[model samples]
Target chain A: MSVTAPLGFRAAGVAAGIKSGGARDLALVVNDGPARAAAGVFTANRVKAAPVLWSQQVLAGGRLRAVVLNSGGANACTGPEGFQDTHATAEKAAGLLDDSAGEIAVCSTGLIGERLPMDVLLSGVETAAGQLSRDGGLAAADAIRTTDTVSKISFKRGSGYMVGGMAKGAGMLAPALATMLCVITTDAELSSEQLDAVLRAATSRTFDRLDTDGCMSTNDTVLLLASGAAGVVPDLAEFEQRVTEVCADLARQLLVDAEGASKAIAIEVVGAASEDDAVKVGRSVARSNLLKCAIHGEDPNWGRVLAAVGTTDAVFEPDRLNVAINGIWICRGGAVGDDRSKVDMRPRDVTITVDLSAGPHTATVHTTDLTADYVHENSAYSS
Target chain B: MSVTAPLGFRAAGVAAGIKSGGARDLALVVNDGPARAAAGVFTANRVKAAPVLWSQQVLAGGRLRAVVLNSGGANACTGPEGFQDTHATAEKAAGLLDDSAGEIAVCSTGLIGERLPMDVLLSGVETAAGQLSRDGGLAAADAIRTTDTVSKISFKRGSGYMVGGMAKGAGMLAPALATMLCVITTDAELSSEQLDAVLRAATSRTFDRLDTDGCMSTNDTVLLLASGAAGVVPDLAEFEQRVTEVCADLARQLLVDAEGASKAIAIEVVGAASEDDAVKVGRSVARSNLLKCAIHGEDPNWGRVLAAVGTTDAVFEPDRLNVAINGIWICRGGAVGDDRSKVDMRPRDVTITVDLSAGPHTATVHTTDLTADYVHENSAYSS
Candidate 1:
């Protein structure tokens, strides 16, 4: 179960004939609730997909009764006709669900600069809406995958309430958000304003810190919906914590399944002048292609780490920097320290700790090692 | 002839026994000039190499009698001992030439973080100093090779004067200069201030635009020395142009020899509100691994181009953007335009033109396509 793990949520998935080989390409989730509230975050890239634009408008109204997602086409860079198609999709979904078009959110992923087969998609949407059930969460999650090897789902039980989420992304993962679409649902009684604040806080710490390839996408969207069917007015602090836990779980899942990744590396930056400085330093280190390759090769090349750190403007003296890999202090005070050969990098998970020795702030950024498989996967993606 | 193509210059290369293969790894270039005017630029990385630190101080005096460069070790991140090695090398070269250490510069390229063999290097400097001659430019160029397969040399004859240069870099090429060591010689009668201004202008338009792999190095240095032996006060504008031509030729050579690269891409951003915006847009597109991979696969994936353009703060409306690969405009008004199939990518050289449709300003950035070979080269680099 994914979204439907939360009470008052029903979901379904259907083959839309939009994707080749007749794979499941469409999904729907409905809020069968006494109250409906929603919040959303979209890609920071100026060029946004058609569904992202449509969903953003619906979410701005602070109420959503249903969400319809398709994975055959991103509908980005398709001009005015793409936006019209997205509008038509929402209108069709609302007509079948007996709700206003403004209450239905739409999301799309897959190839950009292409038009979706609207007839097949609309029919698939109708079939999915009719099949919506409490146990259809897993099916819905499975439908929204492009190059993803597996569907991502997570759930956390709260104090007399529950929160759950599903996400789909394989590549183009970077700051602000990955090239991903995530829908989180909860049965706790909370206002749309409260949901927005909690979602922003959770994503900023989790999703925003993931920089797999340093490539920002045009179709990244994360949504949160609340249904009051649980009839429990949960404590705000506990609610936020549960939501954050679910998001973190899903984010880690994304990391583990990053495209062609051989290692999952965490760059933890500490002793910074400020939180912003820490994040800057961590992101700089995370984006280094050479350092990522060294990690892939199991070479404890701490010099590349320091080279990456030196490229940032964060407050720190070069000679005061320290770096550790796998708990082995390979570089101390900006020079070779502990024997690098003693650091074991045979494991898939690697942690690099950087001490700026400037202040007390810290941040951790997650990334994947650069590999030949990544070049192979992305080179043939569009073709 | 490389740097020695200009009058009043002598150079030599010798085996330093520091490299494993006993290859010629030490080079000495002496400006046997009546005038010793010099100008230099170094890497922008804050954690600079010891050689860069030493050379900057020597160049600050506006005079350089000789430059000693060694391969096999970068002398970077080696703590105080690394600085000491660079100082000792300069002192030995200056002593051999009966000059002050402040007038001698040093350059090192290869693996970072390992201390160089000081005794072997000092002796090799003595051999190089004794062998210096007018015809030793080619040997000097060959000695600076790390991963470089061939030596890079360029020369342009001005009215009664000449500008010639040699550069060594195969990977880690990026903005604010590359992981390269370059020595340019000119016989034109120019002051140190004139040399500094002209060198900066020429490099900003040439070497600074080459960004292969987008990784800055800790030891990037470009030195220009004027021997003023031609006894000709060439026109300043013509001299700058000649120098820029030589720099541009060497930059292209670096691009062609970029490690594991199969295609050389020139991303030209036109119709920008400002030149900086144009360069920002061009660089963003050039750095996109997705786009680079697509180019390598010979696919006209214009959508990746738009995605990269959207990531920049450059002045452009999403719908008005246009991109053309080779001469075919595959994207216009941010949508699919002419037939992508018509774009031929069979050649090693590729040109991608992006039209921001904002203003008349424009810029061009040079880069290499991402490939599995790149991953292989960098992964095993420091091992």
Candidate 2:
């Protein structure tokens, strides 16, 4: 399964001179189908980019034929001019595809508070439309990238249809959806409500669990367009399951590409009185810079983890808490357990477990360790 | 006005080999009192150090004579033995000062989850006690530090009394407090209730408003001891004013010495519907790593600021919000206001102003920028 596995969809990617390194920075994907059902999730951040706002309004009716994306300028904080640019770009794509402007979605990534070059953007849209092909899915995935070291794409095969998606983000990532910009294509015949329900459920557990630095972005967007090109629609449960797999795969890929990330960490909080408590405890540890740095150094600093949990509103006796790092029980009943010297944390994957000893409720949050390279990359970028 | 400027107090500092660099790592200050009223504020973190638990219990009675602090080995997560080490250290200090062990407060900083070398600690306590002097305030201030670039000490002379304090912390500093340890001494006769009232009031506005990375610490403790040796007790009004000033000064110094700090930022939120709203908005900006990094680069990224505040529960119209960076109004009513280029942010001191246009409530939170040096220093240190 690949991004092009979805039927009745054609994609094209191009270089548009938006990025300094001449990387692919323009993409176009069109639904050449009998179905136009669409759903989208955008950044909760109030300071949204022009494209995010524009695409959100476009998706409100649950109908979309195509999407145009570019990487370089975020088109955020550019005032009315930025919104006008997004509208104009959408109109240009609409003209080439002979579709209503409102039926087209737009997304942008890269430095924030910068305006997109209208000339380059308009020309790039034309080029992308001209180069659109059924086998262009890989190119589309590559175009919508910025600081990401590689493109993120996921796919899942269903009994009658398929789900495919491409995402781009490295830092400024958090549960509120981070700075990610993603596009998903499907060949399942689904309504607006059904698509939204499945998308929300999948996102809640996938994208929402990827927290690198706990920083929300102003240009985050994820759009799903389903074209009834496969001529078959499975039951809601089956479609939802496949959707979840695709989202989870993309989310995992995003974590793997997290900026300056040395390891992918899974922080699990178990035996909590409630799921909320478990999630709260897990997020607290996921957001602790000290703990993340410790993990980066492979020090297995369970004390920092305990301290993080203590700061949460979760009910737990300090002495009753137990902690494990990388399968080694380093602390038990709120006291030091086994010798930390015996724990090995050199692997790229790390797991931290906290037993609250309250009940059976549990939750797990995915995160990445903090490293100097993360700081260097972020500080060097204008965004 | 130094730590020793307060009446009825003598302080001393010495090298104890606790710090790998052999810097001053042991400090002692005694209340040669006619009045020994005291109050304390400790870390809210659940994974507390053995010394924090001991100090908290001893301070419950509001009577303290001396405080002993070391700059290396936090003595946290060391299990029962850590508790024993804390008790032994306090006992040694009590023996030398001819006071009950419970009356002596102990604090340890540096790497977490590490055990103290009891032999070296005992010898250091003895050396600190013998080196105690009336004018050893500066040395004492220098000794109780870890990862701090400079010593933090502030003093104020009252009509007939004096107030002084010393503090140490770098990162893991936030509103609920960080890895901080502070000691305040005064020569004003006051009851335990009075001391608690004044200290709480001062802390709520001063130390609580200093948030670096939003990571609360496990060993944050602030001790205030009063001795009536000066035979001058002012009214509650004057005492509160003096205490507030001392706390404010110490808080400022802490911000100045923040780890990997390249700039000190003051985020002021005004015209909120309530003080809580103001604090929430201010803290949102203070805790945003992206905003901090943007500020570090001197990029007036007001969009990130707005995005951060948007995530808060504070009620406000997006277009009704106004923001200013470094005295230049960059955003008005949630849109571009002026030329961002005019807002020069190259200086180390940066101020962000947000107008909620809801009411008269306001709050100011102090924070530091996120930088590569911060990540480097924190990740390089092995727990």
Candidate 3:
């Protein structure tokens, strides 16, 4: 089921003339009742978008009644006018929902540094509000997209309620907590603190491990809002699990939709001296364009992988290191292992296992193959 | 003047069949007499090439007579056999030069992990030694290239002597001291410690500021060998300046030949709180694929530039930050400064200036536009 498939929540999506292609440019997801608690994670980039700054402050006190999202203009680096535009949009959304402006969150994605066309945006907001329905989740999901080829939404049925989310991103994606604009809605009763904890834990493993291009965005944000319509709060343990599952599902979708991506690569580092070391090594490999490109070319260039891992400070003897690509041992004891000719890397799913032989700790990072389309798409755009 | 133009040095380049295309694959550069001091820098990557490890140990005492290099195989992560191959190659070179094995430095680049066709490599060494000449510098430069489209060589006449060098790299390049293999021959006398200082200072601003694809290689190395054959070593200050100039020229050439690069972009961060901050900001911009691609498309997308700078920790009020692309102020105070139509970004050479307005420190980094050709080349290669 989709995010708005729950009770006491209504969502709508509308074309706002913001996108040049005339796709849905405005989307609204609202909670129609009793619970009004929210938590959010924003981009670590010190230069935040105007909408990100506005929503961050609004979510500070844990109250959120609606999220007003628009696709087309990022509303970033637009200075004072951008900030004012964000405020005005929030005010309009809150007015339509019969709530205070302070209770609405704002999100924008698309080209950066452009001002929002307020005339179209305002009219689109009115249309969205008029069309709001509990079953409109799928439409809303399809609305908040920029470069993403497909809409990403995930749902998890918990002990008493359900957690659902929609995310949009294809590039400028990396992670500290989350790497894209994601809005999650739930019918379970949850306080701000519990939501914060569960969101952080869930993101730590899910979104935080996906590095498509290693570019972190100024508009990256993840918002979790609880409707409390079910009137049944889940135990903290179960709530965390459900949240984590939903996040994982969403993260997987983001990876699958990474720009110019043909394969979703999983680099697993095992036998590291510590979990941190494994993560460090995995990240190094995940960010290596050479290795990624080689993988895209279907070349079992295990040496590039070794080179990436070696660049990290993680302690391990090169001789003790072992590498396997696509379930075939390519290198062992710092030397060539089995016949590399036997390894096939043309599959859409690729895995690289690096055994450090240092400790029991392990970590896995998801990445995408480098492709010509990535360069073409990114280079052709002005933003 | 080229590297071998210096007195007391003999060099040669020969085809060893290491390259499948039947190109030159072996080079031998030797110091004939009167000097034995050398200094070296190797890739910071932990998964080092076999030659890098061997040279790191041999250059520790600061004395060397020759450097034996080969293309077509990096000899990295090949385990014990790789190390053995490197040793044998070095020993053979030393034997031909009438020098100790420990006195000869070794470097190899090409495909990584594959064993060197020892039979071909050893025979090529003999051919190279027999063909050694003082005018073989250019041939040596050409012999060491893998995917590089052009030969990189530079020379400078110091107060009383001369310094010349060559380098080869087209991808898997970034600045962490050095990103590719280079060798310099100097007629001036200098100790190992002195050479180290001079090399470090030169590289700090030259090779250290180059970011091509943001990928660090496993076989990067830079070696400087002084012959002291002229017996007219000048003051260290004058010598260092000349060395820096030569390195800068070579570094620029490397950028020009960067894979799939259609334009060379220079990003300068001025008025930063500290030099480190300025460097950090410059690097952040240099490593951005979106910005690089935008520049490639001849689109002045200043928003990507601001977004990149925002990801860094440099202290700057986002609104106060001003960006000038190709000498036109596209953004000021985090907003559009002037008409974007006035800014032209169609030049092959472009400069982006970011005024942090926080301090007096500044830094500049060299990068290239990301193009479809680069993606096509890298994605098709296995190594």
Candidate 4:
């Protein structure tokens, strides 16, 4: 159970020939509530998909009655025709669900610069509307997968309330957001303003920090809907923390399922003058292809880490920087500190800690090692 | 004949025990000049190697009698000892050549964060000094090989002068400079100020724009020495152009010999608001691993190019963008244009022209396709 784990929400998944081999490729989530509060975040890339452009407009009203999502076409770079298709999809879902067209949001994912199968997609929307159930959360999660190997779902329980979410992404993960589509639902009593504030706070520290490949997508989106069916107002501070935890769980799942990844690596930068500096340092280190390849080979090459950090403009003296790999201080004072052979890198999880020795701010960015499988997977993706 | 092709110059290459298997790893070039005028450029990375720091100080005096270069180790991040080793090497070369220590420059390339075998390097310097000859430019080029497949050498004739150069770099190439060591010698009668201006102008458009892997090195150095042996004061503009052509030739050689590269890609951005904007957009596209991988697979994936352009802060409207692969305009007005199948990619050379349609400025960045061989080479390195 994910979105449906919360009360007053119905979701369904169905195949409509949009994806070949009759695999499920359509999902619909509807909030049947006394309150239809919603919030969303879209890709930072200026060249956004048509669905994202439509959803951004619909979400500006701070409400959403239903969300219609499809896989197999990104509906991007198709010009005005693509925008019309997204509008048509939202209108079709609204007509079937007895909701206003302006209250419906749409999302699309798959290959870029392609058009969706309109006839199959609209029919799938109707079928999903008729088959909606409280236990259809898992099916909806599975339908949005492209290269993801498993369904990502998480639920966190607050006092007399519930927060649940589902996400699907594999590659092209970067800052602002990964190439993903996520739907989150809650039964806690909250206003549109409160939901928007909480969602932004949660996603900023979770999904925004997961950069697997450093490639931003044109179709990343995350939406949160509140039904308020439980009729209980939660403490704002405690409720925000629960929402953050759920988002963090989904982000971690995305990292674990990243395309062709053999190891989940975290670059933690500490003693920065500011949070931005810490993030800058972490992201710079996370994007080092040489360091990623070295990690793939289980070599504690701290030199590559310093080289990457030196490229950034963050405040740190070269000779004062320190680095540790897997709890072993391999580089201290920008020189060799310990025996690199003593560090064990056989585990799937690896952590590289960088101490800037500047201040107290810290940040962590997650990424994957560079491998031949990654090169193979990406090289053959568009073929 | 490369560096020694110019009059009043001698060079030599020698095998040193610093390199395993007795490969040539040490080189020396001396300018027996009536006028010792020189200019140099170093890596932009703040965490520079010991040799870079030492040479930066020597080059500040605007005169250099000789250069001592080695390829077995990068002598970087070794604390005070690393700096001392570089100073000692330069002093030994100066003593052997009957020159001042302040007039001797040092350069090194290879693995970073390692100490050199000073004992072997010092002896090799002595041997190279004794064997310096006018025809040793090719051997000097051969000695600076780390992962380079072949030596890079170029020479151009002026009215009554000669300019020749040699370079060695295969990977860790990025903006500011590549992981390279280059030495240029000229017989033109020019002052140090003129040499500095001409060298900067030439490099800014050549070696500085070749970003093979988007990974800058900590030990990049390029130097030009003028001996005034020809005693001809040529026109400055024409001389600068010739120097630029020689630097461009050496830069192309570096691109052709990039580590594990299967395709040499040129990303030329046109119709930008300014030159800096054009370069920013081109470099952003050059660093896209998805685009690189797609090119490696010979899949004309223009959507990846658009996605990369969207990530830059350059001035461009999404709907007005266009892209061409090789000579086929596969994407026009930010959407599909000509049939992608019409494009041929079997050739080793590929050109991607991106029209921002924002203004009239233009820039080009050279790069290479990301391949399995690249991943394999870097992954197993230092293991």
Q: Using Cα atoms with residue i matched to residue i, what is each candidate's TM-score against the true structure?
A: 0.98, 0.92, 0.96, 0.98
- Candidate 1: lDDT of B368? 91
Give the higher-TM-score candidate: 2 or 3: 3
Q: Write the per-residue lDDT of candidate 1 for residues A211-278, one digit (tens) a residue.
A: 88888888898999999889998899899899999988988999998888999999999999999999
Greater TM-score among 1 and 3 belongs to 1
Pairing residues by index, what is the TM-score of model 3?
0.96
Candidate 1's DockQ is: 0.62
Fnat score for model 2: 0.58
Return the top candidate by DockQ: 1
Per-residue CA lDDT of model 3 for B273-346, tens digit only, reads 99899989998899887787778878888888888888887899888999999889989888889888887877
lDDT tens string, model 4, A1-383?
99999999999999978989888999999999988989999888888889999999999998999999888888888788889999999999989988898989998988877778899999999999999999999999988887888989999999999999999887444221236888999998888899889999998898888887778888899999999999989999999999999999999999998877888999999999898999999988888888888899898888888888888899999999899999999888887788888899999999999999999999998999988788787777765
Q: What lDDT score goes with residue A56 in model 3?
A: 88
**DockQ for the candidates, in order:** 0.62, 0.50, 0.61, 0.61
Runs in model 4 deviating more than 4 A are: A171-178, B171-178
Fnat of model 3, as a fraction: 0.79
Compared with the true structure, all predictions reach lDDT values of 0.89, 0.84, 0.84, 0.88
Clashing pairs in 4: none
The fnat of each candidate, in order, is 0.70, 0.58, 0.79, 0.66
Off by over 4 Å in 3: A171-179, B171-179
RMSD, one per candidate, in order: 1.7, 3.0, 2.4, 1.8
